[model samples]
Target: MSDEKYRETIIEQAKKDQSAGKFQSESPGFRSLVKSYVSVVSPDRKNIITEGLTAIYKNKNPQPKTLNLIDYLLGNVKYCKEASDVSYAEFYDSNGEMVASYSNGKWISYGTKAENARESELWGIYNEAWNNAARTSQKNSYVAGTDTTIGLMDISV
Candidate 1:
């Protein structure tokens, strides 16, 4: 294509974008209404993961609590979820082992039977864990004050 013709085509597209109100070639332009899934280590997720883990362990019977400050670091734990109303997350440790998982808005604890306890009685732990995992992923970005939206469906918490 000749340079003149290429310029005309580009100009036409820009005009269409402006007419559709989807183009804003200026600083602080319109933020995208759509958000894509991103995976990254996030501070907010670290705090949440440890909080939920501690809460569940505290109520567990006959075991040391994972209440240490370092426990929530997330490390290599894969925090998975999506933006849908119904989503879930599985926390895989450094060695690619799933330590605990929350699914369908419920917490599924790993370990001995006594550790898991009764699902009916463990709603508190499940709720805390699920909310922390879901909300942060949908809201937090790898950068501060940016348009980047993350879908935890493939990242770590």
Candidate 2:
């Protein structure tokens, strides 16, 4: 089924479940159902959905912090060797133009393309890398934070 259609189906089912009292509000089943709906949503829509849910649920968890582009790249496998142990780090395109730099926790983007590296694609590969890394980090942290192990098996059994 199309993603939109699947999402609609899940919503309809959720409505039915709610009216029939199949799952109580704030119950584990309700949260699981919400997660199912959220999983199929597109990225932009997910943000809007999350905002609405946050308003309703008033989530109290602290938000995960993402590293800035320069900070992210400095520790990244591909770029780390270039600036290890230095207080400064700079990214350059294949054409030898300076794209961005990190100094004393500040990021500066070169050229007229953008007021900042985060706002400009002129940072190119570095920007993409940082975005991918940040997204992965967020996903990993979410999974790690939410996962629970119920119990261990008895080896004697």
The best candidate by TM-score is: 1
**lDDT per residue as tens, model 1, 20-136:** 444423312221210000111112344445755454444433332343435534433333333322244555444344556677778764442322343222333333434544455
| TM-score of every candidate | 0.23, 0.22
Candidate 1: which pairs clash? 79-156, 81-152, 81-153
Alpha-carbon local distance difference test for all models? 0.40, 0.40
CA shift of 128, model 1, Å = 39
Question: In model 2, which runs have C-alpha deviations exceeding 4 angstroms?
Answer: 22-29, 40-69, 73-157
Best by lDDT: 2
Q: Candidate 2 — which pairs collide?
A: none
Give candidate 1's root-mean-square deviation (CA, Å): 24.4
- Candidate 2, overall lDDT? 0.40
Against the true structure, what is every candidate's RMSD?
24.4, 23.8
Measured by TM-score, how close is model 2 to the native structure? Answer: 0.22
